[model samples]
Target: MKIPEARGPVSAGLLDLLSGQPGADPAALANLHELVTVQLRAAGDIIEDEDFQLALFCLYELHYGGLEDVDDHWEWNPGLLGIRQLIEAPFEECLRSAALGCTTETRLPPEGTLSSDDVAAILFGLAAQESGPSMSRYVAKKATLEQLREFLIHKSIYQLKEADPHTWAIPRLTGRAKAALVEIQADEYGGGRPDRMHSALFARTMRGLGLEDHFGAYVDSVPAISLAAVNMMSLFGLNRRLRGAIAGHLAIYEMTSSRPNQLYGQGFRRHGFGAEVTGYFDEHVEADAVHEQIAGRDLAGGLVEAEPGLLGDVIFGATAVLAIDGRLSSLIMDAWDNSRSSLRAAVPAGL
Candidate 1:
């Protein structure tokens, strides 16, 4: 994808340097890190801070499908890593605080030797307790076709690359946890049918709505919190030390998904969309019911049982996803409720 438009000076300078020849001076990158430190210190709510999130998103993108003309070698440039850490430190702290909330005391099971079933129950209970104004319900009963387009654009940030984030944990785990993750991912990948891959399914929905189907097609339109949600998963997944967190994260997603997906499909169908557009949500309604069990029990619970010490991190991962996604949901719903567009930039015609 082409480098996105800069959201602020930090992102602007970072993008400028990223376009330099492979081997831009480490000292120059260090100077850019200094600018980031100053910017973050004065920022209010870094979670919604567009410049910070965009810069972080671009930096992380280096490890994914990189920018159009940027040098791939920057993926590991020591200077770039230093700058990334500068932003990551505070962003991670904010996420931890959001995840903690009042649930910290009750986030985990009592201390003891717990079986996978026991752990699964705890994860299941966590998901069941998610009660609030929901994006799904709005999508089901009220969203206009334009609002639905906004909804898919917000989701496309992550859905376009579904399962890739959690797949990072495959090599980091072993035994039941490994097998469980692979099984879930296999289905996400369409079990050997390329066209049925979840990402492809999502792209079809985009096109059915008269939207572009390419990855990153709408990145610039979504708000900071939308990017932040996806970044949280990547943060947990890419770090081997956060293996437990990523496992818990996927489990939370599967556990909470099935019912909401049904509503999402209903919303699209209410507008008379056929199988072509609603297929993504319809697939999830069925798939996630099965995935939730494997992910919560065999994947997340089994990992905690084997490692014993990662239980806290597992809970953190689950709650973090809830926290981040809640923010994104509110962003969209709040805008809709007030009769405003939720995107950072207005979507163009037919989008």
Candidate 2:
């Protein structure tokens, strides 16, 4: 996507640099550092920092699918990477402090205690016990068509490339963990059928709503909270050191997915949309039911079994997913409740 209109000095500077402007000099970097330091020190809310979070999102985007007309070389440039790390270190710390509690009290699975079945049981318990705000329930029973469309827009940021973030772990894992990841990813990749790919199915859902289905088409419209939710996955997935966290994230993601998708599909039907419109959600209702099992048991459970030390990061990842998603859902639902648009104002047409 074209660089989003900047929200603050750092973003403004970065955008100017990307546009080939010459004013983003050391002064801009100094301004960025000061901004981050302030946000880091007295930041009241990590989940809602539109400026900081969106800036970080744009940095991470370079590695995934670089922006149009941006220099590809910037993806690995030391200067850019340094700035990213400066931002990311605080963001990661904020997430950990906000989500994962002290590890000292968390019980570790005893040596040799981790089996596939045991892993499934733990994930199942986590899923069952999670009581996050039910965005899906609201959508099913109370959402207006416009609200549902907005929900789809927020989701499309990630759904359009649904399994790619987690797939980064495929090479980081080995033995049972590796095999299990491949199994789940195979289905996500549509098991050799491009038409059946989850991303394509989501695209169909977007089209059914008369929304744009192209990647990053709605980036300018979504709020930073929405972007941060997706960025969390990419962060965990891209780092080999965070493989356990990614696995845990995926486990919880799948475990929590099935039921909500059922509700979402129902909401679509309630709005008079047919199977084609709801097919993406409908498919998840069935697919995630099975995928959750594999994810929690073989994928997550197996990973911890192989490397017991990763248990804490795994749990941290799961908790982070809950925390971030809960915040995003709360923001959207609250905005709609107050009769405000959850999205930023649509950008002016034709530039």
Q: Which whole-number lDDT from 0 to 100 does residue 79 have in model 2? A: 65
For model 2, the stretches where C-alpha displacement exceeds 4 angstroms are 21-44, 101-108, 347-351
Tens digit of per-residue lDDT, candidate 1, span 1-351:
677889999999899999887564766677798898899889867888999999998888888888889999999988888888888888888988998761533354567687898778877877876534699999999999999999999999899989998998999999999999999999999999999999999999999999988878788899999999988888888889999999989999999999999999999999999999999999999999999999999999999889988988888898888888877887788899999999999665667
Q: 54-119, model 2: which lDDT tens digit per residue? A: 787788888877777887776776666767777777677877876754222325478667776776
Backbone clashes, candidate 2: 0
Report how far off residue 1 is in candidate 1 (Å). 1.8
User: What clash pairs does model 1 have?
Assistant: none
Question: What's the distance in Å from true for residue 34, model 1?
Answer: 1.3
Clashing pairs in 2: none
Reference-based TM-score, model 2: 0.90
Could you list the CA RMSD of all candidates, in the order they appear? 1.5, 3.1
